[model samples]
Target chain A: MGKDGEVDFSIIGLENEIEQIQSNIDDLENGKGGSIAIIAEQFAGKTTLINKVCSMNKNRVEMISLSSVVKDEKKLQEIEEQKQIKIIDNCHFLYRHKIGGFDIIERFLKTVTSPENKQYITTWNIHSWNFLENTHEISKYFPVQIKLQGLTQEQARQLILSEYEEGEIQFIEDPTENKEKMINFVIDNTIFLNKEIGIPHLKINYRQIKSKLSRKKIILTPEENIFENIYSISKGNPGISKAIWEQSLVYPQIKPGDIKEPCQDMELDNDESFILSILVSMQNASRSDIIEIAGDEIDIERALQVLSKKNIISSEREHYTIKPEILKCATNFLRRSRLV
Target chain B: MTMVGEESGSLSGMPSIDTGTLLSVISLLIIAYVVTRVISFLLTAFSEKVGKYRIKIKMLLPILKFSIYGYTVYYIMAKLLEVSAQELILFGGLLGAAIGFGLKDLFADLIGGIIIVFEKPYQIGDKIRVGDQYGEVNDIGIRATTITTPDDNYVSIPNYVIFTQSVSSANIGNSEMMVVTDIFLEHGSDMKIARKLLKEAVVTSRFVYMSEKHPITILTKDFPFYIRLRAKAYTRDLRYEFNFESDVSSRAWKELKKKGIKPPGANLIDSSSMPDQRDR
Candidate 1:
């Protein structure tokens, strides 16, 4: 739904770091303030990941998006008076507003931390490596700094293939000549950008490229071995490989599948149907918003948890997007079986 | 001298009897008693018609009874002694002083009773604290007051205590008053989640009134090594204060379990024993 190589359920190489992030969140909640700066770059999934963590807590945590109140002092004071956990998003405005606006927030934090009152949870967004360098003064108060990085190629491939849940991706021998070029393109430009593009997006792009190569009937040398060689160059950068593969899919070598009629007669069980319907209807939503739309239903939470464990749907931010292959499977299941 | 002695002897021989005068004195006393009885009856009837104040009736009955007796004694003594006015006046003065000294405490108590009735430092059915004892005032009398404490102990204290000691009167005449309860949880607990659940637990309780604008607050106090979470709210009735307290605490505990939160296991010290010497 976003970039071509987004990671699915697995965080992959950042396993240790993810554990640290979990603990850091726990520490922040416990009112042990030791960190000063949080540096997250663009498309780094900072907001999404934080939201996911926040959801784990059902009632104890009150996540407030600070971007909504960056301008109004009165409203912010009211929120501070309520004394709940506050998550401030879109903090790029700190640079935009010239930091003076944050003075009120600083005052609130000082009062909250003082002996007279209770400590509160506060989260603010800071982008780029320079966030730590620029906010040297502000960072003195915030003791933790977490840097967000993108997914690796293996992680991306796991995400894409796992989208189908029961099956793995099979790279058949490419009989077409263009497979060499597509594979080479993936190896050269894609894996190098693993930090940017996630894994699932890469496979979707590769799938499209494979379709194009088959249509042209060009002679491709060592077709099945292409993925291995491409992976060698791509390394683990799912984003780049996905991007290159996506571009390769548009070449004349490919033949497009005939569009089937939309499945209108599908009748899925509430949990399955609702999950699939929500996926089909919204197309894309942040992880937070999905939890919210689930409303008061415990079943929805269970469904999401099951789906996440099964790697059918992956989340970024508040939006839970369907993996391209999962979407296709769901579509095929609905069209053929009419079971939503 | 011989003639005077004979005359005195003759007078003494007559036994000092004054028949007509004695007869008139007896008649007068009989008449006076009748008059007193008639007047008392009318007064009693008038009082009954006017008001039903038991103290007023009690006061009037003693005065009337004494007046009737006094009149009879004065008339009989005057006829028998044939004393001078100056002698009677001197005797009356001495008698008054003796009575006054003997009844001084009784008089003070009576005045204190009057003060309580009119001044109304507290009224019946008022929850009050006199000196160190706290209770609801069930009866207020001229000489003493009756109060029922929370433990259902009924105590009778002299009325003068109201004038002498400081009194804490809550809803002195009204029935509605604020009741507060504090709950403490352990440190390292999920304060945010714990607080929310506790607040919901307090406000959602059936005993809690919903009209209040401010919501129930869960205050977190961080001591040297532990955190204390206190839940405070108002209740509808003072009598239900304990019920409200226990209900809120129990509900909060259950909610904590449902939310998968464990409160700090450390024992909580009741803060009531600590007095705030400083101004609040």
Candidate 2:
């Protein structure tokens, strides 16, 4: 009721992009023949930048996303007719095996960006430069190129702060204590900026914070405290962070001010204790390797299945690896738990 | 020829040879050699013919061929020369140590090959991961195992390595394996919404299989600024993981964004959570 829809700001960074994208829009509005492409690595903010341009020119320009329309040329033509600014999001998917030919791309580009159509086009990819050779061959048809790189530290910091605020996430830090630490804390943990909704995305949140603190109360289970302590230490990577948090959260709820000594006070269920042992062993394994090793054991498989379902771990073929932030958080918890 | 005759005479304990005796011996020697060659060829041809019907039998062609030749030579000595079969057999035993030392690895591989045939650690068309290498078993041999990888490269590993090294067989000796994909959402996003979107994504996807074990589920936990949201679903076939993952990820992203759920903040967490050297 209080604008409290989880202050999830999906927009962040791209300050420099906002201006260039606006210019692109202006050029398109004037019926410019040139096309622009934004490219980056996977998860490197390519689509976000292109989307920002489309959003900036929303009313003045019509945009179409051509990612999923692989086998259907008609759908693409239809979208082009409906939209003024044609943007293709998953351009890679179109070229992958039997989907389409370069002729389609060439035809689409020529039709959309022709002077007669008075339209503009933008394409997004993780690596725009990789398309340089191909685009050069197609230059006689469509010839605009733009490459996106990683964010600057300041931009990254701003990006992170925005995501946190948008999420309505509260940091327990007192500003007067050390401003540098606060900024560095957010900057170091933040991977990138959000483009659609502006906000810094933190690596961890309040529920995780609560779970880390509630490892006490289960009188019969003490080992759960290790999981709780580890979750707190992990700082929220989905994989290890949840592993520790879930293990600890299963314990009886405990207040934040309950007491200091986690090792001496906490209790855990047998299953929680068993999970902690594997989690502890998992500290030394990559997510993929863990999946490989644990594939045979029902309990380990169950744990990994749960972990992967939680997005704590990812698998490619026989290999599995925990997400980066989750790894960070889980290890931190382990270190802290060990210290305790 | 004189020296050969002298050696043969000493071995045979004959004093001297007349022209008729020498001619007869030479003809007999020529006949024995010809007979052995013809028999060897016939045996090898039969081995090849048998090999076509059975893989295990095919792998034994070299051994079977050698054994046939060895026994044939012994037969020529015993039957042609009128020498005792026991003497030929004894001579083979005396040469055993020499052959063994020279062919230790070969012998080991051969034995390992036999083990492979009987133990059946892998067979043709089984997906297997051995050490750092993963591929489908193309053919199993007595001394080596041939595998073709997903990249289309064929690798031949020694049968002995298979016996000694750790091997991981996926799909539990079956052709099908569960392929899963993960979907991430912005922190504080409606978990129910995300879950529903993911379930829809999986259910709507052509590749996704709806089974009791593979039911899609969404999980939530704190991940930095965003509550790390994940939707996981399984594919009955492992080969579709690549396509399924891309499809689900893109769909889930579109759904989450359309629902107005932003991604997590970019801010870093407290430095205390940064990995220590010990974490690795």
The numbered model that scores best in DockQ is: 2
lDDT score for residue B269 of model 1: 44
The list of candidate 2 runs beyond 4 A from truth reads A1-340, B1-102, B210-234, B261-280
- Model 1 DockQ, alpha carbons vs. true complex: 0.00
Query: How much is the lDDT of residue B82 in candidate 1?
Result: 55
Q: Which lDDT tens digits does candidate 1 get at residues B1-280?
A: 1121123535654323355656766777788767767765676565433221322443344345445656677756664545457657866788678658785555466566666656666655557888778887755544567789889999987766755788777654543344555555556777877776676666544345333242455677776545656765655444455667877777677667776776545454444533331211
TM-score of each: 0.30, 0.30
TM-score of decoy 2: 0.30
Error in Å for residue B144 of model 1 = 1.7
In terms of lDDT, the best-performing candidate is: 1
Q: What's model 1's overall lDDT?
A: 0.49
Q: What is the C-alpha lDDT of each candidate?
A: 0.49, 0.48
